[model samples]
Target: MTAFKPALILESVDEIPESAYIWHWKTEHHFPFHKHNKGQLTYVEGGAAFLYTRDKTYFLPARHYMWVPPGVEHYFQHRYPANYVRTIYFFTDEDDTSDPFYTRTGIYPVNNLLLEMILYTSKWDGNVLPGTKGYRFVKAIKNILPDISEQPLPITLPTTENTRLKPVLKFIQENLAESLTLESVGQEFNYSERTLIRLFRSTMDISFFQYLKLARMIRAMGYLLETDKTISEIAWDTGYNSVSAFSNTFYKLVGKRPSDFQ
Candidate 1:
């Protein structure tokens, strides 16, 4: 298993002065769990991801945005290889004492207007002249943001206070591509297979096998979008011994053929 490293502070938005810094990141491993003091609005431009906080885990796919409130500790897991994410971190006034805002986590439709703005803002070179087209574009993004919240929390994690399960969860994430069995997982942690199953079901509200499949499917999506590898290659890389089995699972979860996506 590869070591998961802490997130490298990839360009801070504050460094760009008046304009926000829009950046794209491609990740293969779980981003070392961490948080920032400033707020962040992130969108999964391509691939699938699992976002985990102290209280819950949110599954994010394309066309959905997540707003992380300031000082919230959060981490991300790329279920698939070649995970691509676009993020915009805007700086707000520190002295402005505003009401406590809920972290917005929901599935929102991606319209042409939003997609166009994302493309334009992503390439903005930080030259925003007053009363110019770029200036108006920036203003439009801010105006549309308040209307973004359709709900407070969309996908919720099963466990909220299971600190004891952290090590087990981390083990599953780290060894996702390996042929993991309940017996093996239990032996490694000195628990009986039944006990392990009970614990997993109680803590995550999903069976161990289901969680593992979700993790694998997440990684498969990343590979599909980020690499030139064929579907067979991706399936092998993601631990499927048979291409047919991998294809069937992929079709079931993503609702499209891998070749069609390519």
Candidate 2:
């Protein structure tokens, strides 16, 4: 993938900068490594978004969300233009809460209530000052957050330390634009095709094709957002044979056409 410009650290601007905060953006830019004093739940309703931490990379298409516990240092890029992104900062007294996705950063689904509440609260920011009854309407959304804590999350690539698989993963990432195959990669790494398949599927819990598609789609998404390249040009740049092929793959993986992000 091409390099992106440096990310910017955003400062808290909520009038009542206490237990909770809601922020939204619709731009093609990056948020640099920063943390909120409160735990965070991020929602992306339009375009594409990519969240990066020290270890893992997460992809958020439209309608997906990710949870970041308080003080989890991270940065994210607007993977496509016209991004409608919102995040809710939460304050919890119990840091040791037991939720499947709590504190563990991963992409998950968003329900209608979650989506509506986030957008509804965003509208009340400056208009409804704190201590007002309308302000508590936002806090009421907090009660809904705990219910979906156990929802299944789509885990993409996480940084692995295993020496045998580490270099192979790195190779796949570094060569995402190439016509890569498990057999070829395994041959280069001195492993059998079946061994490679098993390792990728069993160890990583993601198949080789799934992982590669993830890489290619990720790069393609960035191209669609950050550059003005034609869809066909991006298709070729990302190893797709044609524009339609790239669009199909993007739609299959991301649930939206390439032009939708454009």
Candidate 3:
């Protein structure tokens, strides 16, 4: 497939000293799977996307929001033509004057208040007259942070004791960058490739190859958030031989291009 880059427009990176930080980007950009070092609170302003993490995959549409903890590798797959994402990176260090980071959470309805706060925060012009309103506004947001964390996990994986599938899943997760074959994966589990296929379909409700792609996409998301690697390098490292091939698949899944992420 031919790779077509998605159009992305990123606003300035707002660096707030010591309290919190925010960044905004508007794009139909589908970024390959990647991760980040900071805890992230992301609101899908418009359009739809999927968020793949180690344990689950979240389908985020308009008005949906997500909270991700630091060091948890994740990525987004865009599902709409014109989606905008506004993300806030809450500094996690306790000594930085803010409270500790919230726990991981995924895909939940955006509350009206939360939505309004997001809009206000996105437009915050650093010059808040020193007063109770600013302090209260920040406090209110902080209070809701935990509520967001309490939202359910977006995607659920099967919890089967099949034992046979464990090693296979582990192998795929570990070798996300490799061109994986069901035959090779089955060999590691001492089963015929056909048997592995049956097991995955019966137990996971998805084909083995589908699961593998999801895994690769998940890993790609982590890299996109955490690293500054070029799109081509990221594609190769994530088992895509060509940037075009990777971008095509990513666009189909994420709805945007790799460059739009940064």
Alpha-carbon local distance difference test for all models: 0.63, 0.69, 0.62
Off by over 4 Å in 1: 1-39, 43-51, 55-72, 75-86, 89-103, 106-112, 122-136, 142-163
Q: What is the per-residue lDDT of model 3 for residues 52-162, given as tens digits with 9 covering 90 to 100?
A: 675566656566677776667677776554345777655444522353435544566677888888777765432222244654575466567665545553343332446
- The best candidate by lDDT is 2
Q: Is candidate 2 or candidate 3 better by lDDT?
A: 2
lDDT of 3 at 141: 69
The RMSD of every model to the true structure, in order and in angstroms, is: 7.3, 7.1, 13.0
What does candidate 2's lDDT look like per residue over 151-202, in tens digits? 5433455555567888998898788778898888998899999998888776
Ranking, lDDT, top scorer first: 2, 1, 3
Which segments of candidate 3 are over 4 A away from where they belong?
1-19, 30-32, 93-101, 125-139, 157-194, 197-262
Counting clashing residue pairs in each candidate, in order, gives 6, 0, 19
Candidate 2 lowest-lDDT run of ten:
1-10
- lDDT for 99 in candidate 1 is 27
Q: Global CA lDDT of candidate 1, please? A: 0.63
Instruction: Report the error of model 2 at residue 115, Å.
Output: 1.5
- Distance from true position, residue 211, model 1, in Å? 0.5
Please, what's the RMSD in Å of model 2? Answer: 7.1
